[model samples]
Target chain A: MGYFLRVNILETILIYVVIPAAIFGVAALLTLVPGRAKSRPKYHSGDSWDYPAHWWSGDNPVAVGSIPDASNDVTFGGARGTW
Target chain B: MAHGEVVASTPLAADWQEPASGPLGDAALPLTAAQLELLDDVIFEAERITGLRYSVYLGDLGTDTRNMAEGLVKGLGADGPYTVLLAVSPGQKVVEVVTGAEAAQRVSDRSARLAVLSVVAACADGDISGALVNGVRMLADQAGTLPERTNW
Candidate 1:
Protein backbone atom coordinates (compact mmCIF):
# COMPACT_ATOMS: atom_id res chain seq x y z
CA MET A 1 0.00 0.00 0.00
CA GLY A 2 2.80 2.42 0.95
CA TYR A 3 4.78 1.46 -2.20
CA PHE A 4 1.74 1.93 -4.43
CA LEU A 5 1.03 5.30 -2.80
CA ARG A 6 4.65 6.41 -3.32
CA VAL A 7 4.86 5.25 -6.91
CA ASN A 8 1.55 5.88 -8.68
CA ILE A 9 0.21 3.61 -11.51
CA LEU A 10 0.97 6.30 -14.11
CA GLU A 11 4.57 6.70 -12.91
CA THR A 12 5.12 2.91 -12.79
CA ILE A 13 3.75 2.42 -16.28
CA LEU A 14 5.76 5.34 -17.62
CA ILE A 15 8.99 4.16 -15.98
CA TYR A 16 8.75 0.41 -16.66
CA VAL A 17 6.87 0.24 -19.96
CA VAL A 18 6.39 3.48 -21.83
CA ILE A 19 9.91 4.88 -21.49
CA PRO A 20 11.63 1.56 -22.17
CA ALA A 21 9.43 0.84 -25.17
CA ALA A 22 10.12 4.29 -26.56
CA ILE A 23 13.83 3.85 -26.01
CA PHE A 24 13.83 0.42 -27.61
CA GLY A 25 11.93 1.68 -30.64
CA VAL A 26 14.23 4.64 -31.09
CA ALA A 27 17.35 2.49 -30.68
CA ALA A 28 16.07 -0.14 -33.06
CA LEU A 29 15.26 2.54 -35.63
CA LEU A 30 18.65 4.13 -35.31
CA THR A 31 20.49 0.85 -35.88
CA LEU A 32 18.16 -0.39 -38.62
CA VAL A 33 18.17 2.80 -40.65
CA PRO A 34 21.95 2.57 -41.10
CA GLY A 35 21.76 -1.17 -41.60
CA ARG A 36 19.29 -0.73 -44.43
CA ALA A 37 21.44 1.93 -46.04
CA LYS A 38 24.47 -0.32 -45.95
CA SER A 39 22.51 -3.21 -47.43
CA ARG A 40 22.63 -1.62 -50.86
CA PRO A 41 21.45 -3.99 -53.55
CA LYS A 42 24.44 -5.94 -54.83
CA TYR A 43 24.62 -7.74 -58.14
CA HIS A 44 23.58 -11.35 -57.86
CA SER A 45 24.14 -14.03 -60.52
CA GLY A 46 21.45 -14.11 -63.23
CA ASP A 47 20.34 -10.63 -62.19
CA SER A 48 20.25 -8.28 -65.15
CA TRP A 49 22.73 -5.47 -64.83
CA ASP A 50 20.88 -2.17 -64.92
CA TYR A 51 24.00 -0.14 -64.30
CA PRO A 52 26.21 1.28 -67.03
CA ALA A 53 29.20 -0.66 -68.33
CA HIS A 54 32.36 0.60 -66.66
CA TRP A 55 36.01 0.00 -67.49
CA TRP A 56 38.19 0.21 -64.41
CA SER A 57 41.97 0.11 -64.49
CA GLY A 58 44.82 1.77 -62.63
CA ASP A 59 44.93 4.17 -65.59
CA ASN A 60 42.67 4.59 -68.55
CA PRO A 61 43.55 1.99 -71.22
CA VAL A 62 45.05 3.51 -74.36
CA ALA A 63 42.64 5.14 -76.78
CA VAL A 64 40.58 2.85 -78.98
CA GLY A 65 42.53 3.85 -82.09
CA SER A 66 45.78 2.59 -80.56
CA ILE A 67 44.37 -0.69 -79.23
CA PRO A 68 45.78 -3.54 -81.33
CA ASP A 69 43.44 -6.02 -82.92
CA ALA A 70 43.24 -9.67 -81.84
CA SER A 71 45.15 -10.76 -84.98
CA ASN A 72 48.26 -9.00 -83.71
CA ASP A 73 47.94 -10.34 -80.15
CA VAL A 74 51.22 -12.01 -79.15
CA THR A 75 50.31 -13.03 -75.62
CA PHE A 76 48.07 -16.01 -76.20
CA GLY A 77 48.33 -17.20 -72.60
CA GLY A 78 45.26 -16.59 -70.43
CA ALA A 79 42.04 -18.16 -69.19
CA ARG A 80 38.35 -17.52 -69.69
CA GLY A 81 35.36 -18.72 -67.69
CA THR A 82 31.66 -18.16 -67.12
CA TRP A 83 29.55 -18.46 -64.00
CA MET B 1 35.85 12.89 -44.39
CA ALA B 2 38.50 12.16 -41.77
CA HIS B 3 39.97 14.25 -38.97
CA GLY B 4 39.91 17.47 -40.97
CA GLU B 5 39.00 15.94 -44.34
CA VAL B 6 36.76 18.11 -46.41
CA VAL B 7 34.09 16.70 -48.73
CA ALA B 8 33.75 18.67 -51.91
CA SER B 9 30.61 19.24 -53.95
CA THR B 10 31.00 18.34 -57.62
CA PRO B 11 28.78 18.45 -60.67
CA LEU B 12 30.57 15.46 -62.21
CA ALA B 13 29.70 11.92 -61.11
CA ALA B 14 32.02 10.22 -58.68
CA ASP B 15 33.27 7.78 -61.37
CA TRP B 16 33.95 10.45 -63.95
CA GLN B 17 37.07 9.67 -65.98
CA GLU B 18 38.55 10.66 -69.31
CA PRO B 19 38.45 7.49 -71.37
CA ALA B 20 40.21 6.95 -74.67
CA SER B 21 37.16 7.97 -76.65
CA GLY B 22 36.37 10.93 -74.44
CA PRO B 23 35.16 11.57 -70.91
CA LEU B 24 32.74 9.52 -68.82
CA GLY B 25 30.62 12.68 -68.59
CA ASP B 26 28.38 12.86 -65.52
CA ALA B 27 27.85 9.08 -65.33
CA ALA B 28 28.02 7.48 -61.91
CA LEU B 29 29.96 4.31 -61.29
CA PRO B 30 28.07 1.39 -59.86
CA LEU B 31 30.62 0.53 -57.18
CA THR B 32 30.81 2.09 -53.74
CA ALA B 33 33.89 4.08 -52.78
CA ALA B 34 35.00 1.37 -50.40
CA GLN B 35 34.70 -1.31 -53.06
CA LEU B 36 36.62 0.78 -55.56
CA GLU B 37 39.34 1.44 -53.01
CA LEU B 38 39.64 -2.23 -52.24
CA LEU B 39 40.03 -3.08 -55.90
CA ASP B 40 42.58 -0.33 -56.45
CA ASP B 41 44.63 -1.46 -53.46
CA VAL B 42 44.54 -5.08 -54.54
CA ILE B 43 45.69 -4.25 -58.05
CA PHE B 44 48.46 -2.05 -56.71
CA GLU B 45 49.57 -4.70 -54.26
CA ALA B 46 49.46 -7.41 -56.89
CA GLU B 47 51.64 -5.41 -59.25
CA ARG B 48 54.13 -4.57 -56.54
CA ILE B 49 54.41 -8.17 -55.40
CA THR B 50 54.66 -9.70 -58.89
CA GLY B 51 56.58 -6.93 -60.63
CA LEU B 52 53.93 -6.92 -63.33
CA ARG B 53 51.41 -4.32 -64.41
CA TYR B 54 47.72 -5.04 -63.81
CA SER B 55 44.44 -3.74 -65.19
CA VAL B 56 40.76 -4.53 -64.69
CA TYR B 57 37.78 -4.01 -66.98
CA LEU B 58 34.22 -4.23 -65.73
CA GLY B 59 31.62 -4.21 -68.48
CA ASP B 60 30.24 -6.12 -71.41
CA LEU B 61 32.67 -8.25 -73.49
CA GLY B 62 30.48 -8.21 -76.55
CA THR B 63 29.79 -11.44 -78.53
CA ASP B 64 33.32 -12.77 -78.85
CA THR B 65 34.56 -12.41 -75.28
CA ARG B 66 37.85 -14.25 -75.77
CA ASN B 67 38.78 -12.17 -78.81
CA MET B 68 37.80 -9.01 -77.01
CA ALA B 69 40.01 -9.94 -74.06
CA GLU B 70 42.90 -10.72 -76.40
CA GLY B 71 42.54 -7.43 -78.22
CA LEU B 72 42.56 -5.42 -75.00
CA VAL B 73 45.81 -6.97 -73.84
CA LYS B 74 47.40 -6.80 -77.28
CA GLY B 75 46.51 -3.15 -77.42
CA LEU B 76 48.63 -2.43 -74.35
CA GLY B 77 51.73 -2.26 -76.66
CA ALA B 78 54.90 -2.09 -74.54
CA ASP B 79 52.93 -2.72 -71.37
CA GLY B 80 51.32 -5.78 -72.94
CA PRO B 81 54.53 -7.75 -72.47
CA TYR B 82 54.34 -7.28 -68.69
CA THR B 83 50.61 -6.65 -68.28
CA VAL B 84 48.06 -8.89 -66.65
CA LEU B 85 44.59 -7.83 -67.64
CA LEU B 86 41.53 -9.24 -65.91
CA ALA B 87 38.39 -8.50 -67.84
CA VAL B 88 35.04 -9.12 -66.19
CA SER B 89 31.66 -8.81 -67.86
CA PRO B 90 29.12 -9.17 -65.10
CA GLY B 91 26.28 -8.50 -67.52
CA GLN B 92 27.33 -11.46 -69.64
CA LYS B 93 28.62 -13.43 -66.64
CA VAL B 94 32.07 -13.92 -68.15
CA VAL B 95 35.62 -13.43 -66.87
CA GLU B 96 38.89 -13.47 -68.75
CA VAL B 97 42.43 -13.08 -67.45
CA VAL B 98 45.04 -12.18 -70.07
CA THR B 99 48.70 -12.79 -69.34
CA GLY B 100 51.54 -11.25 -71.29
CA ALA B 101 54.39 -13.28 -72.79
CA GLU B 102 56.54 -12.46 -69.79
CA ALA B 103 53.59 -12.82 -67.45
CA ALA B 104 52.85 -16.22 -69.02
CA GLN B 105 56.24 -17.61 -67.97
CA ARG B 106 55.55 -16.72 -64.35
CA VAL B 107 51.84 -17.65 -64.38
CA SER B 108 51.03 -20.67 -66.55
CA ASP B 109 47.80 -21.32 -68.39
CA ARG B 110 46.89 -23.90 -65.77
CA SER B 111 47.58 -21.44 -62.97
CA ALA B 112 45.62 -18.71 -64.73
CA ARG B 113 42.79 -21.21 -65.12
CA LEU B 114 42.90 -21.82 -61.40
CA ALA B 115 42.53 -18.09 -60.81
CA VAL B 116 39.65 -18.04 -63.27
CA LEU B 117 37.92 -20.88 -61.43
CA SER B 118 38.14 -19.03 -58.14
CA VAL B 119 36.71 -15.94 -59.80
CA VAL B 120 33.90 -18.03 -61.22
CA ALA B 121 33.06 -19.33 -57.79
CA ALA B 122 33.02 -15.83 -56.31
CA CYS B 123 30.94 -14.50 -59.18
CA ALA B 124 28.41 -17.26 -58.56
CA ASP B 125 28.01 -15.85 -55.07
CA GLY B 126 27.79 -12.30 -56.48
CA ASP B 127 31.05 -11.17 -54.83
CA ILE B 128 32.66 -9.24 -57.66
CA SER B 129 35.02 -7.26 -55.44
CA GLY B 130 36.06 -10.29 -53.46
CA ALA B 131 36.65 -12.20 -56.66
CA LEU B 132 38.84 -9.48 -58.15
CA VAL B 133 40.89 -8.82 -55.02
CA ASN B 134 41.43 -12.45 -54.19
CA GLY B 135 41.85 -13.59 -57.77
CA VAL B 136 44.43 -10.88 -58.43
CA ARG B 137 46.25 -11.88 -55.27
CA MET B 138 46.11 -15.51 -56.36
CA LEU B 139 47.72 -14.60 -59.69
CA ALA B 140 50.40 -12.60 -57.93
CA ASP B 141 51.14 -15.57 -55.73
CA GLN B 142 51.36 -17.82 -58.74
CA ALA B 143 53.71 -15.36 -60.43
CA GLY B 144 55.93 -15.56 -57.36
CA THR B 145 58.70 -13.02 -56.72
CA LEU B 146 60.72 -11.60 -59.59
CA PRO B 147 63.81 -13.76 -59.95
CA GLU B 148 66.50 -11.18 -60.73
CA ARG B 149 64.95 -8.11 -59.09
CA THR B 150 66.24 -7.50 -55.58
CA ASN B 151 63.85 -5.84 -53.17
CA TRP B 152 65.67 -3.99 -50.41
Candidate 2:
Protein backbone atom coordinates (compact mmCIF):
# COMPACT_ATOMS: atom_id res chain seq x y z
CA MET A 1 0.00 0.00 0.00
CA GLY A 2 2.83 2.43 0.83
CA TYR A 3 4.62 1.68 -2.45
CA PHE A 4 1.36 2.11 -4.40
CA LEU A 5 0.72 5.48 -2.73
CA ARG A 6 4.24 6.69 -3.50
CA VAL A 7 3.91 5.64 -7.15
CA ASN A 8 0.49 7.36 -7.43
CA ILE A 9 1.92 10.64 -5.98
CA LEU A 10 4.90 10.48 -8.39
CA GLU A 11 2.54 9.86 -11.33
CA THR A 12 0.35 12.84 -10.31
CA ILE A 13 3.41 15.13 -10.02
CA LEU A 14 4.69 14.03 -13.47
CA ILE A 15 1.36 14.48 -15.18
CA TYR A 16 0.32 17.75 -13.42
CA VAL A 17 3.61 19.62 -12.69
CA VAL A 18 6.47 18.24 -14.78
CA ILE A 19 4.60 17.97 -18.06
CA PRO A 20 3.09 21.47 -17.80
CA ALA A 21 6.42 23.07 -16.77
CA ALA A 22 8.23 21.33 -19.64
CA ILE A 23 5.59 22.44 -22.15
CA PHE A 24 5.75 26.07 -20.94
CA GLY A 25 9.55 26.06 -20.88
CA VAL A 26 9.70 24.84 -24.48
CA ALA A 27 7.13 27.45 -25.54
CA ALA A 28 9.12 30.28 -23.88
CA LEU A 29 12.35 29.11 -25.53
CA LEU A 30 10.68 28.96 -28.91
CA THR A 31 9.45 32.55 -28.44
CA LEU A 32 13.00 33.74 -27.59
CA VAL A 33 14.61 32.02 -30.61
CA PRO A 34 15.39 34.37 -33.53
CA GLY A 35 14.28 33.93 -37.17
CA ARG A 36 11.05 32.27 -36.05
CA ALA A 37 8.77 34.94 -37.52
CA LYS A 38 10.38 38.26 -38.35
CA SER A 39 8.44 41.48 -38.80
CA ARG A 40 8.83 43.64 -41.94
CA PRO A 41 8.72 47.41 -42.25
CA LYS A 42 5.28 48.83 -42.80
CA TYR A 43 5.04 50.51 -46.21
CA HIS A 44 3.02 53.63 -46.88
CA SER A 45 1.44 54.52 -50.22
CA GLY A 46 4.33 56.67 -51.51
CA ASP A 47 7.03 54.49 -49.93
CA SER A 48 7.83 52.84 -53.27
CA TRP A 49 9.07 56.14 -54.69
CA ASP A 50 10.79 57.18 -51.45
CA TYR A 51 12.82 53.95 -51.21
CA PRO A 52 15.82 53.87 -53.58
CA ALA A 53 15.67 50.09 -53.86
CA HIS A 54 12.16 50.31 -55.27
CA TRP A 55 12.65 53.47 -57.31
CA TRP A 56 15.98 52.65 -58.99
CA SER A 57 15.12 49.00 -59.57
CA GLY A 58 13.41 47.66 -62.69
CA ASP A 59 10.52 46.58 -60.48
CA ASN A 60 9.20 50.17 -60.47
CA PRO A 61 6.12 50.43 -62.63
CA VAL A 62 7.12 53.90 -63.81
CA ALA A 63 9.64 53.90 -66.67
CA VAL A 64 12.51 56.17 -65.67
CA GLY A 65 15.02 57.38 -68.28
CA SER A 66 18.30 55.52 -68.87
CA ILE A 67 21.44 56.46 -66.99
CA PRO A 68 23.93 58.52 -69.05
CA ASP A 69 27.32 57.10 -70.06
CA ALA A 70 30.57 58.28 -68.44
CA SER A 71 31.88 59.45 -71.82
CA ASN A 72 28.91 61.78 -72.12
CA ASP A 73 29.63 65.44 -71.32
CA VAL A 74 27.14 65.64 -68.47
CA THR A 75 26.54 69.31 -67.91
CA PHE A 76 25.53 70.48 -64.41
CA GLY A 77 23.12 73.09 -65.60
CA GLY A 78 19.86 74.54 -64.12
CA ALA A 79 20.03 76.12 -60.64
CA ARG A 80 23.40 75.21 -59.15
CA GLY A 81 22.54 76.87 -55.84
CA THR A 82 20.25 75.06 -53.43
CA TRP A 83 17.01 76.75 -52.49
CA MET B 1 -16.69 29.07 -5.41
CA ALA B 2 -15.78 27.01 -8.46
CA HIS B 3 -12.45 27.52 -10.32
CA GLY B 4 -14.32 29.00 -13.31
CA GLU B 5 -16.11 31.57 -11.06
CA VAL B 6 -12.76 32.56 -9.42
CA VAL B 7 -11.15 33.12 -12.87
CA ALA B 8 -14.19 35.14 -14.08
CA SER B 9 -13.90 37.50 -11.06
CA THR B 10 -10.42 38.72 -12.15
CA PRO B 11 -10.30 42.17 -13.82
CA LEU B 12 -8.68 42.42 -17.30
CA ALA B 13 -8.68 46.23 -17.50
CA ALA B 14 -5.37 48.09 -17.75
CA ASP B 15 -4.43 51.29 -15.87
CA TRP B 16 -2.81 52.93 -18.93
CA GLN B 17 -4.17 53.76 -22.39
CA GLU B 18 -2.39 54.76 -25.61
CA PRO B 19 -2.40 58.45 -26.46
CA ALA B 20 -4.53 59.62 -29.37
CA SER B 21 -1.57 61.54 -30.94
CA GLY B 22 0.69 58.61 -31.79
CA PRO B 23 2.88 57.74 -34.77
CA LEU B 24 0.19 55.51 -36.21
CA GLY B 25 -2.21 58.46 -36.35
CA ASP B 26 0.29 60.72 -38.10
CA ALA B 27 0.53 60.93 -41.88
CA ALA B 28 3.86 59.37 -42.81
CA LEU B 29 3.47 59.95 -46.56
CA PRO B 30 1.04 62.67 -47.51
CA LEU B 31 0.57 61.67 -51.14
CA THR B 32 -2.07 59.13 -52.13
CA ALA B 33 -1.70 56.37 -54.73
CA ALA B 34 -3.34 58.35 -57.56
CA GLN B 35 -1.32 61.45 -56.69
CA LEU B 36 1.93 59.49 -56.72
CA GLU B 37 0.99 57.99 -60.06
CA LEU B 38 0.31 61.46 -61.41
CA LEU B 39 3.67 62.74 -60.23
CA ASP B 40 5.41 59.67 -61.73
CA ASP B 41 3.71 60.22 -65.06
CA VAL B 42 4.68 63.86 -65.06
CA ILE B 43 8.32 63.04 -64.27
CA PHE B 44 8.46 60.37 -67.00
CA GLU B 45 6.92 62.74 -69.51
CA ALA B 46 9.39 65.46 -68.59
CA GLU B 47 12.27 63.02 -68.97
CA ARG B 48 11.01 61.84 -72.35
CA ILE B 49 10.56 65.38 -73.66
CA THR B 50 13.88 66.80 -72.46
CA GLY B 51 15.88 63.64 -73.11
CA LEU B 52 17.09 63.94 -69.55
CA ARG B 53 16.49 62.08 -66.33
CA TYR B 54 14.05 63.78 -63.95
CA SER B 55 13.82 62.80 -60.31
CA VAL B 56 11.89 64.33 -57.43
CA TYR B 57 12.82 64.05 -53.74
CA LEU B 58 10.23 65.20 -51.23
CA GLY B 59 11.47 65.26 -47.65
CA ASP B 60 13.27 67.29 -45.03
CA LEU B 61 16.61 68.87 -46.11
CA GLY B 62 17.89 69.67 -42.64
CA THR B 63 19.48 73.15 -42.30
CA ASP B 64 21.44 73.47 -45.55
CA THR B 65 18.90 72.59 -48.22
CA ARG B 66 21.27 73.49 -51.06
CA ASN B 67 24.10 71.25 -49.91
CA MET B 68 21.73 68.36 -49.36
CA ALA B 69 20.19 68.90 -52.80
CA GLU B 70 23.63 69.08 -54.41
CA GLY B 71 24.72 65.89 -52.68
CA LEU B 72 21.60 64.10 -53.87
CA VAL B 73 22.24 65.28 -57.44
CA LYS B 74 25.89 64.23 -57.30
CA GLY B 75 24.91 60.80 -55.99
CA LEU B 76 22.97 60.17 -59.20
CA GLY B 77 26.22 58.64 -60.54
CA ALA B 78 26.74 58.69 -64.32
CA ASP B 79 23.25 60.02 -64.76
CA GLY B 80 24.06 63.19 -62.79
CA PRO B 81 24.71 65.36 -65.86
CA TYR B 82 21.60 64.17 -67.66
CA THR B 83 19.54 64.37 -64.48
CA VAL B 84 17.39 67.14 -63.05
CA LEU B 85 16.72 66.67 -59.36
CA LEU B 86 13.90 68.61 -57.76
CA ALA B 87 14.15 68.62 -54.00
CA VAL B 88 11.12 69.94 -52.16
CA SER B 89 10.87 70.29 -48.42
CA PRO B 90 7.31 71.37 -47.94
CA GLY B 91 7.66 71.66 -44.19
CA GLN B 92 10.49 74.10 -44.61
CA LYS B 93 8.80 75.76 -47.57
CA VAL B 94 11.98 75.24 -49.59
CA VAL B 95 12.42 74.03 -53.16
CA GLU B 96 15.78 73.35 -54.78
CA VAL B 97 16.36 72.41 -58.39
CA VAL B 98 19.73 70.80 -59.16
CA THR B 99 20.60 70.00 -62.73
CA GLY B 100 23.49 68.02 -64.16
CA ALA B 101 25.97 69.93 -66.35
CA GLU B 102 24.13 68.80 -69.48
CA ALA B 103 20.71 69.58 -68.04
CA ALA B 104 21.86 72.98 -66.74
CA GLN B 105 22.84 74.03 -70.23
CA ARG B 106 19.28 73.47 -71.43
CA VAL B 107 17.36 74.46 -68.26
CA SER B 108 18.56 77.82 -66.99
CA ASP B 109 18.50 79.16 -63.43
CA ARG B 110 15.84 81.68 -64.45
CA SER B 111 13.74 78.85 -65.83
CA ALA B 112 14.21 76.88 -62.64
CA ARG B 113 13.17 79.90 -60.58
CA LEU B 114 10.07 80.24 -62.70
CA ALA B 115 9.30 76.55 -62.19
CA VAL B 116 9.78 77.05 -58.46
CA LEU B 117 7.37 79.95 -58.47
CA SER B 118 4.74 77.83 -60.22
CA VAL B 119 5.26 75.04 -57.75
CA VAL B 120 5.08 77.43 -54.81
CA ALA B 121 1.87 78.90 -56.13
CA ALA B 122 0.31 75.46 -56.47
CA CYS B 123 1.57 74.47 -53.04
CA ALA B 124 -0.04 77.54 -51.52
CA ASP B 125 -3.36 76.25 -52.78
CA GLY B 126 -2.75 72.86 -51.11
CA ASP B 127 -2.16 70.93 -54.34
CA ILE B 128 1.17 69.23 -53.83
CA SER B 129 0.70 66.67 -56.60
CA GLY B 130 -0.55 69.32 -58.98
CA ALA B 131 2.40 71.49 -58.09
CA LEU B 132 4.81 68.67 -58.88
CA VAL B 133 3.10 67.91 -62.18
CA ASN B 134 2.98 71.55 -63.22
CA GLY B 135 6.52 72.14 -62.05
CA VAL B 136 7.86 69.20 -64.06
CA ARG B 137 5.97 70.29 -67.16
CA MET B 138 7.22 73.86 -66.81
CA LEU B 139 10.78 72.67 -66.29
CA ALA B 140 10.62 70.41 -69.32
CA ASP B 141 9.18 73.21 -71.44
CA GLN B 142 11.92 75.56 -70.25
CA ALA B 143 14.60 72.93 -70.98
CA GLY B 144 14.26 73.99 -74.66
CA THR B 145 14.48 71.63 -77.62
CA LEU B 146 16.44 68.37 -77.50
CA PRO B 147 19.69 68.34 -79.43
CA GLU B 148 19.44 67.02 -82.98
CA ARG B 149 20.98 63.58 -83.64
CA THR B 150 23.79 64.15 -86.12
CA ASN B 151 24.31 60.42 -86.74
CA TRP B 152 20.67 59.92 -87.71
Deviation of model 1 at B92, angstroms: 1.4
As a whole number from 0 to 100, the lDDT of residue B119 in candidate 1 is 94
Candidate 1, residue B91: Cα displacement in angstroms equals 1.7
Query: First chain TM-score in every candidate?
Result: 0.43, 0.39
Q: How close is candidate 1 to the true structure, as a TM-score?
A: 0.71
Which candidate leads in DockQ? 1
Q: In model 1, where do residues sit more than 4 Å from their true spots?
A: A1-21, A34-39, A59-73, B1-28, B147-152
lDDT of 2 by residue, B30-147 (tens): 5655666777787766665566778887777768878887777677766666667777666666777888776776788889988888877766666656767788888889875455
TM-scores of the candidates are 0.71, 0.55
- The lDDT for every candidate, in the order shown, is 0.77, 0.64
Candidate 1: DockQ?
0.36
Please give the DockQ score of every candidate, comma-separated.
Answer: 0.36, 0.10
User: Residue A58's C-alpha lDDT in candidate 1?
Assistant: 56
Chain B TM-score of every predicted model: 0.78, 0.76
